[model samples]
Target: MSEIQKALVVHAEEAERIGLPHGGGFRLLADGRDTGGALGANRLSLGEGAAGARPHFHALSTELFHVLDGVVRFTLDGVTSIVAAGGLVSVPPGTPHSFGAAPGSAAELLVVLTPGVDRFGYFRALGRIQHGLGTFDDLLPASEQDRYDVHFV
Candidate 1:
């Protein structure tokens, strides 16, 4: 029998293991190497004061953020914009961008990274840090971040 390889069969414990905590921050439904898919997709939920991600630039992929609830503050190429519920923001490739939840409010959104999907591993590793499963300094050296195809924006 051919071995079946896939990700996404996640339970609460499994979700917690792969960088998701119960009702915390984000949940990754599919990543680059998981399920043999090319696109990196994730469902992110940021509570008050939570930043969506480190401001960074992708050398070769465009990103899109579709808000599901609440308000989100998105910064693209140094300009910040507020997106309300059901709004979507698209950041063109090579733009320096990031997002965060509004202070004292919550936000849920979908994030998609195209072209370079393996980049998802960085976030997964970061999740390990968030879960107290590992220690990463406040800043991850460019050497490490570059391995996951990220660069300072």
Candidate 2:
């Protein structure tokens, strides 16, 4: 099938290969193939008291985020910045960064990972660990977090 056909035929049911983790308090909205090319777009909606992804670096990729609603507090290279509605932020490759919505408010944001990194696999692994629905410890070892270049403070 053509790429467009592939995309259009994708239903929410077939997209069940992954889901957000328990602690994440967010629902993920894209699969690895959604990007179609170098650009991959995903979204995370934060609930009250919810934080975003773990601090991570993409040695071979870059990312951009556009805050659609609510307040988001994000960190870049240890520096904290708040992104409110209609705000945009960009992070270059190899930069350590993470984001979270302010307490008691809902936040909506679009996250685009360029050159798409291994995000699909990372999130799938996270869901496995968080939900206990499956086992995938062999895929993502805690000791080799740096191998993925993801770190937490």
Candidate 3:
């Protein structure tokens, strides 16, 4: 007899929230291990003018973002675009990208990474850096960044 895999569910109120220094935050829904390495998911809330992420790329994962509220500005390669609520953007592996809440606009987003890389720790470290508990240099090592699949350009 085959064993049945249980479903994974995270209620909004129960999600782990990681607060950023600039009024932005991340609500962690699922990590790669929880999904058997299939995907990782999270919700990001950014206050007006909040920086989301600096230029980076995943060498092995594709990232998807769904704008749930307000507007977001995304830079792919060297082109920048404004994505309003309800917009979706898919970034393939190796594509350099960055994002932030559009100037003067707060934003909410659902973010997913496929072929999941365990990235919750990466997010946590980022939060710590933002809060002055850690330094960006901590994540600057190639081995450290590779562990989370984020390669800064």
Highest-lDDT candidate:
3
| Model 2 lowest lDDT segment of ten | 18-27
lDDT digits (tens) for residues 27-54 of candidate 2: 4455345656455555666776576776
Candidate number with greatest TM-score: 3
Write one digit per residue (lDDT tens) for candidate 3, span 1-153. Answer: 754546899999999999987787999999988887889999999999898999999999999999999999999998999999999999999999999999999999999999887899998998899889999999999999899999999
Decide which is better by lDDT, 1 or 2: 1
Which ranges in model 1 have alpha carbons more than 4 Å from their true place? 1-23, 35-37, 131-139
**Local distance difference test, each candidate:** 0.71, 0.66, 0.94
Model 2, position 36: C-alpha lDDT score: 60
Per-residue lDDT over 1-70 for candidate 1, one digit per residue giving the tens place of the 0 to 100 score: 8557654564544442233453445566556676554567777887775776778887767788899998
Report the number of clashing residue pairs per model.
0, 0, 0
After TM-score superposition, the amount by which residue 116's alpha carbon in candidate 2 deviates from its true location, in angstroms, is 1.7
* C-alpha lDDT of residue 141 in model 1: 84
Query: What TM-score would you give candidate 3 relative to the actual structure?
Result: 0.95
TM-scores of all predicted structures:
0.75, 0.69, 0.95
Candidate scoring better on lDDT of 1 and 3: 3
Q: Estimate candidate 3's alpha-carbon lDDT, on a 0 to 1 scale.
A: 0.94
